[model samples]
Structure formats: structure tokens, C-alpha cells
Target: MKKFLAAAVFSCFSLSLFANSFSEEMLNIYAKLSVRFVLMSTLKDELSESVNICIGSKAEDERAATTLIDLMHEHYPAGIGEYKIYVIKSDYSNINFCKEASLFFVLSIEDIDLPKVITFAQENKILTMSYDQVLVEDGIDISLFIGREIRPYISLANIFAKDIYLDNVLLRVSKIYKKQEE
Candidate 1:
């Protein structure tokens, strides 16, 4: 109907106003900001003096993960707040490696069972984020989109189910993803 058409057009227009491109610099900035939104209580016991991040990708490819790590180190040489940033590349085969991380960030990956990663993160209370917004639709907790400005695309339901809550400030600025009811 006319309402549906109007809504769709408005949605597209709103997206147009925001940045839709990807850059490692912007992604690193937003990714760091994303962690700041996690309540201290949620991470108090899980993290010590460091904020561990697992950069996950396919077994054969680690280019994106490496680039992200490089960018993170270059940008945040002193780390974020009181916690130092510790990053490791994960192929998702060694669950123990990822278990030590507070955040699991999905890179460019294919042919891997991603739901299993989500399940693992939920069980472990780890925040799951992705480089691709499309993965947010697939249930990754958060992804950043940038063109004119930085915007976080998030799955609140997914993060909430894992008992991972983001600050209201982030929720206010983010584009939350909701699955279409079938």
C-alpha cells in the first residue's frame, strides 16, 4: 500500500544520509567505541586489565584480520581507557583461543558455520561483531557503516540473549536490526 511504499522510500533515504562505505580507520574507531558501551559490570569479571579481541576469519585467509590489528595498534597505541588492547587472529578451530577473548570480531569469511560462533559467544558472554553489515542480519551483534558519518548496525536481540548489553548512548546513535516476522 501507500504506507509501505512511503516507509520503504524513507528508509532508503535515511540510509543515504549516513556513511555506507568501509574503511579500516573508521572501523577501528567505531570498534573501540563499541567496547566502551559495554557496561563495566558485564566485563569486570570477564576481563582483567586488558580487553582481549579475537579477529576471526576463514582458515585460509587472514588478510582482513591482520589489517584490522595493524590499524588498531596504530590508532590506539596507548589503548582505550584503562585497559590495554590485546588482539589475536582466530580461525575458530581452536575454541580455547577465542574463549580467552572478550570480543569476537568476524572478518571476511566464507564456508564457515557462523551460528556456531554465535552460540559459543552467547555461552561465553562474548560480544560478537562483524565487518559486514549483512552479517548483522545473520545475527552478528554489531557492524559499522560509514560514508558521511559512522553508524553502527546492531542486533540488540542477539547481544541481549548473550547477556551482553550496550550503553543507551550507543543504542541511540545506532541502527538496530530487527528480523522481519515470518
Candidate 2:
């Protein structure tokens, strides 16, 4: 009951933030679904720590991240009180820790100044996601890149297979690549 109440409040708060970020159309679409372009759609009625994007620029990742959280809140209004969405700007260092985050989205892959964020993601058990191909080659779990239809596709072959809980919302992946092998 306490957790439910918490989810109710946080969900509302997050929705308010969403209303400020995305367009009304997007808000409406998100309202009807969990809208996971990755693996977030699988889990239900339970809390999951979302992807923590390491952004090099607030201009790029912040809006998207906020919009996603807000959508989550709106979709699960009464049962999603809190979301673990922690963001950190990239320092372009050689390496970093991402294992703690449920999913790690690298917005500034170039700013990180590393040959492989994928190696790091794999080393620590963090499921990596990126919008770039070179980064995907490094072993990111999902690629949330805007392609053919403007919506991103999920790269199942790239994701690290592990014993982690993923939301069902993510499984309904947008089909960006028509014939890509799974």
C-alpha cells in the first residue's frame, strides 16, 4: 500500500514533467502505452531502474530522458511512484562505471573519448544502448537510433545476455531494419 501510494504520487509528478517536455501528440501516444523502444516494456506492476544516460550535452539527452520518464509515469499513473533515472554528463574519460544502472544510454559517445564503451558496459553487466553504429559494434545491448520510420529499432544480437529483468514495453521493438537478423 505504501509503495502503491508512492508510485501514485511520483507517477503524477513525472507526468507533469512530461507535459512540459514533449508535444501534445506524443503525450497522447505515450499515455496509451509504456512506449519502450527497448526492453522496458516487459516488466509490469514492478519497479525497474531505467537507463541512465551519460550525456555530454544537456541539449541532446536530457529532453529525451525526461520525456521517457514522464511517459512511464503517465502510463502507470497509480503504480509507478518512483523511477531510478540517474544522469551524469560525460567527461570523455577513458573509462567509467555503468553496471549500477539497469540500462546505460550513451548520448555522447564521442565525448567519452574511449575506443569501447561496449567493453566497459560488458565488463560491468550494464546493458548498453546507443544511437551510433561504431558504438554498437563495441557491444551495446540495444540501439535506439532513429532510422527508416524515424523510430529506433532494438538490436537483440548486440545486447548482453544476462539475468536481469527487462520490461515488456521494450519487446514491442520498432522495426527500423526490415531484414536484420535477430
> Which of the numbered candidates is closest to the native, going by highest lDDT?
1
The residue-by-residue lDDT of candidate 1 on 1-182, one tens digit each, is 66556534433542222233335454566455545544332664566788888888775446655766877777668877777888889877765678877888887556456878888888888887787678988878888754344578888888878876676777888888889993
What would you estimate as the lDDT of candidate 1?
A: 0.70
Residue 127 in model 1: shift from native, Å? 0.4
| lDDT of candidates 1 onward, in order | 0.70, 0.44
TM-score per model over all chains: 0.76, 0.48
Tens-place lDDT digits, model 2, residues 1-182:
66556534443443344313333333334323322422353222233644344432134445554554555556655433354444444534523644444455554445344346655655655555553434554555555433233233454554425434454445555533322344
TM-score for model 1? Answer: 0.76
Model 2: lowest-lDDT 10 consecutive positions? 30-39
Error of 2 at 90 (Å): 2.5
TM-score of 2: 0.48
Model 2 misplaced regions, further than 4 Å: 1-53, 56-80, 94-99, 111-114, 160-169, 176-182
